[model samples]
Target: MIKHELAKLVEIAAREAQSKDLIPPTALPEVSVERPQNPEHGDYASTMALKLARAARMNPMVIASAIVSSFPPIPGVEDITVVAPGFINFRLTDNWLREQVPVILGAGASYGSLDIGKGQRVQIEFVSANPTGPLHVGNGRGAMLGNALANILAAAGYSVEKEYYVNDAGSQIEVFSNSLHARYLQALGKDVAFPESGYGGQYMIEVGQELATEYGEKYLDQPSQLGAIGLERMLDMIRVDLANLGVVFDSWFRESSIYKEGKYQAIMDLLKEKGYVAEREGALWFTSTSLGDDKDNVLVRTTGVPTYFAADAAYHYDKLAERGFDRAINIWGADHLGHVSRLKAALTGMGIDHQRLNVIIMQLVTLKRGAEAVRLSKRTGDIITLREVLEEVGADACRFFFLSRSADSQMDFDLELAKQQSNENPVYYVQYAHARIASILDLAKDRDIDFSDGDVSLLATEAELELIRQMILLPEVIEMSAHNLEPHHLPHYAQELAAAFHSFYTVCRVVSEDIPMTKARLKLVQATKIGLARTLALMGMTVPESM
Candidate 1:
């Protein structure tokens, strides 16, 4: 809201300059309102004057003075001062920041929510790891990021749907089925060599044992159709495993269903109608280069099997057209980065708006125990599953660690750090702050203190003001995270808020000897509790009342 007011002021200044013929009417400089790193620059600063001065061939200080003169008197802005190099610094009235406390307490859990999306229907597809094996640590990162993004969007007033695209019609599923079959053969005392490229994890043996118990070697001697049945059962097990990990999908879109329901053919027909498809070298090719791709891509190989790109293109078409979603977001691993350009080009060729498709490529995650690295390669049959990580660290710590950094940056998941219960772990630090506030509230209730009669103006300590300022900025942080599609900012913001509250608690006592100061500090503690609880809720973590 403060940023909006500043932008309005800049717009008015730009208009005044244009009317005076000092700058071209069409050459309005880009304006931005940001908090300066040093507080001495004031609460908010803008560089519009410097930007316009260069264009208008005027002195920077003179341009800044002109813009400041054009701004009308506003309620919250105490003073607008021009500094060196044409920077306009704005000092906000302290009362305005203080007034936000009651408003935050009143809004409670809904304080940071905004109607930015206007209830538009949007769908996010993520962590669609093939249901061939357990979800590993690598897949868990995307799961956490996608889940948090969906939550943020929903909080921002979007009709959000979280989906998982199940790859149930691929060679990977067949290999899993064969792996189970080999394990079954070994259990029946028959000599059978495992396929060279088949999955060899110990979990496959469990699937084989379960199959043996259910059918009692009945389907083992049957035809290859039994393998199809075995694969279906394996996928069901995989889904159960994912559900146990708290990753539930609104829709389990199977690749097989897309082909069986004629959607794949319909997408190919749509591309053909658009004249983007051509026959070359006995294969069907998509003219992606015409749409700004590096080269044309093969949609269907000479063997009549569609490539992965073809399946993906068809899936996206269904998401946008048939589903009637306003936006579609795909959460992919870093290995899938090369596919972004081709997919964007395919969407352009299919007559779909390119902006509607958003692909987020999350960098790789490395798991470690203390100083030693853990090897996790599925191809080599050495992998650390998500279940193992969750079992070792915990769901809360795992989620917190995964979301503690930007998605594009490589993450080092240290098992020792996460397992530690000390303040060194960020999750514990935030949770402790919440628990401390709860303790104070419990004490207040026992002492029969009435916080309603508190005088808010009594809270004048620097740390107390800083805590209030952090609480007031929750709405801004939520908006930024939602617009940038980054949830890592949430935990980082929470840590800063906790630090502010902790410093205030250390210096200012809530149960002081003076009743007036005690009651005022009680209100402050209540506000901190609400903010900390809200932040934890956004990350899908519970704030233990007595952690």
Candidate 2:
């Protein structure tokens, strides 16, 4: 929020300079206020003058000075200086920074809440992996990314809904059905060849055996019915797997519902009416090339079966147009990268703004055990499932490691490191900071010290001020992550905040003989606890009171 406030100051100064004819009347560019990496530079810095120099036909330094002259004095702003090359730096008074401890304490868990989204309805659909098997480790990455984004966006004041779009009706399902049928017949002592392309995971065989036990010969001939039952079993496993990883969707939307409710046909009809649908080679095609795609995509095959693209178009249409979401964010795997442009084109064909549909393509994750690569699951003999990882590293470490990198970057998950109960692991390091603070608070409580009347003005140590500086940036971090659709920032910020608190703890002694100083430092430590816990919570990671 301070960044926004600084940006507003720059904007007002620019307008004042323009009105007085001190600078050319050019429309202002976006005011960018950023924290200077070096504290000596200032608390916050902006380069608006440098950005306007070329357009205004004036020296940047002169422009900066003019803007500063027009800038009004703001409380808590200790000084505003125009540095070389036209950098406008703003520094906050230490007293003002210290005063924020009580404010953070007052806000508690909601300290970082912002109003950037202004109540826009945003639907985040992720980890909708086909309902054929358990969620692999790769799906875990998308799950954490989506869940964290939903948390941060909601904190940034957006009405957010997390959803999982189930692909229960497709060729994949057909293959799974055949596979289950073959296993069922085998379970019943009937020799039958398994489908060549059927799911080969051991879990599928287990499901088949369970199905045989539940219904003997009643579904022996009903492949479709057996398939339906098997699909529900797979979904149940997927739900449990995701739940263990701490990901619960607000809704589970079935793909079959689109066709059952006639939305698929309605969308096709509308596309045809808009001239975006065409018939060629005995197949219905979407003319996406006209809307900037590389080529047209098939909507319906020659056999009269609708393609997956058709179902996806209808699903997104329902999400954005019918259900009334202001925006729909779909987190997908790297394999679906090619479908992005065509899907946007399809949305455009249906008279919807393609920009409203945001697709995040997450790269693959390579699980590792120190120097060795981990690929197979001990139980399924397939790619490792999310449940396996969660059971090994626990949910907090799983979520932390999954979200440590941007969604677009391929990451390696080090199993050995994640399970380590030491500072070498980032998640452990951050949680240890919270646990340490909790211990200090407990010590203070045992000593019968009341920090209720703590005066924040007495806090002035470098470490204490630095910790407060880090704590106050939580709101800005939430807003920035939500605005950029980058949830990775939360984890990185948590580490930085933890490091700051650890530095403060090393130098400052809480519950000392100096009662007033003890109370003030305890209040600062409590504020850090709130900030750290909130950051961890936003990433769907747990805050452990004791390591």
Candidate 3:
């Protein structure tokens, strides 16, 4: 990765300082390498001089100049300069940037793979929507975030698993079942009153109507098992909705199974043994306050029924302790913000490192058609279902818009923009670049011109070199995104890569007057195609050869 390479350069500077006795030779400070926000500054910048000046008791510029002057030559590095405020900047030469074309072509799909995670196991749990009804468009945001993170982590050499925790045994399922039963009775011309807490979605009514037709009046008196039947059907529907959104779970873990398999009791016993459990007001409480929580949380009610927190504690225990995963991540909606500190405390109380658990809260999403805001589903009349939106635009477009903003910020998705085939639609714009490149190469093949042995060193135009620079940053982008657990950067990076390719096409002719130049430019175009394809695949979207 470029960041790692830059760190090595800084280490060289540090060693030079040590050998000259500019600083203490016996001790060296940890080095931090970062990219400059302004491109004119340099490719990469380091501020170790400013950090070390006070300790060395010397002028910042003197320390910075010493480090820059003593640094040995690095390949592809044009010059190392000390800038204002004692910042060291490194710029790559044009030759080095041009030489990356063959490196990109040689690596192909594996261009951005890194070994940062060092093969540690990570589990990403997301979109675990209660299997009581169809998934809403709100749920789609979490799916896109989690799936993309999984792909990024795997590329960074982490053993990652994508999972969905099914809340099948929750109270929502009970209400959903009773609603279905009442609807079934109402459809059969019975005079039963609908329960106040029943699910009033059109989908639930349709399911009840189907049951009425399948076994007419058979479940009228004894509809006790209707909840189980409805839960399974909802689960099947949820699976289809996720697949439509281009997401797949490696495992579907059922919450009900945890209690049946004895893991729930095992966790509870572990907590009680550790003296983290106590009775308060006739209910068993977890001593979360002892670990910095606002108050204690109830593990079991006075009626002896386990709470969701109990199941959640057991689920996390199974993930880190039983399954032996090094890290666990849960993607939740913004409403779960209050649950973070307690969950962390619970994990620490159980003896596992709480820092290993990460909870990301995704803000809400609102769909807009034009000047008006769209909320209710025209079909369901209550919530906008994920399937409805996916079917309306496309899986590719839906995912692109969902990831356009950071997880912590609210987003307004423009429905009309998503359907547009113009550059206004970001997904369409990126895919068109890939398709345009394919057309150019196809035309080249008709004239018996091959790019496999083209002279890549001849690519010297500013556009060509800029495109090459952007292409080489894919590996660096992946490393940064994975390290920070943020995916909003991918969509932005894809647009930049696509724009670079488009700018290059407009300025440099690939099949022009100079045959050798044409051949060299073709190789550069081919490298661009590989970079675009790899990015689209990483986002779990289709790589359309012709859009």
> What are the TM-scores, per candidate, against the unseen true structure?
0.93, 0.95, 0.94
User: What are the per-residue Cα lDDT tens digits for candidate 1 across 245-289?
Assistant: 556779888888888999889989989999999999999999999
What total of clashing residue pairs does each candidate reach? 0, 0, 0
| Candidates sorted on TM-score, descending | 2, 3, 1
lDDT of 3 by residue, 1-547 (tens): 6567778778888888879987655445688888789989888888888887877787778888988877888888877889878999988899988888998889888888889999999999999988878887778999999999999999999999999999977666777778889988988888888788667788877888888888888887655577678788888998998888789999999999889999899989999999999998999999999988998999999999899989999999999999999999999988788888888988998899998999989997787776778764323337768887887778887888887789989987766766663236688889999999999988998888977878988999899998998998899888888999988888899999999999999999999779889989998999999999888888878888786
lDDT of 2 by residue, 322-422 (tens): 99999999998888999999999999999999999899889978888899997743233466678878888777767777888998788887778777742
Q: Provide the overall lDDT of each model, using Cα atoms, as 2-decimal numbers.
A: 0.83, 0.90, 0.86
Q: Which stretches of candidate 2 lie over 4 Å from their true place?
A: 18-27, 368-381, 414-423
Clashing pairs in 2: none
Best by TM-score: 2
Better of 1 and 3 by TM-score: 3
Model 2 TM-score, 2 decimals:
0.95
Model 2 clashes, total count: 0
| Poorly placed runs, candidate 1 (over 4 Å) | 14-26, 222-246, 368-373, 414-423
Model 3 earns a TM-score of 0.94
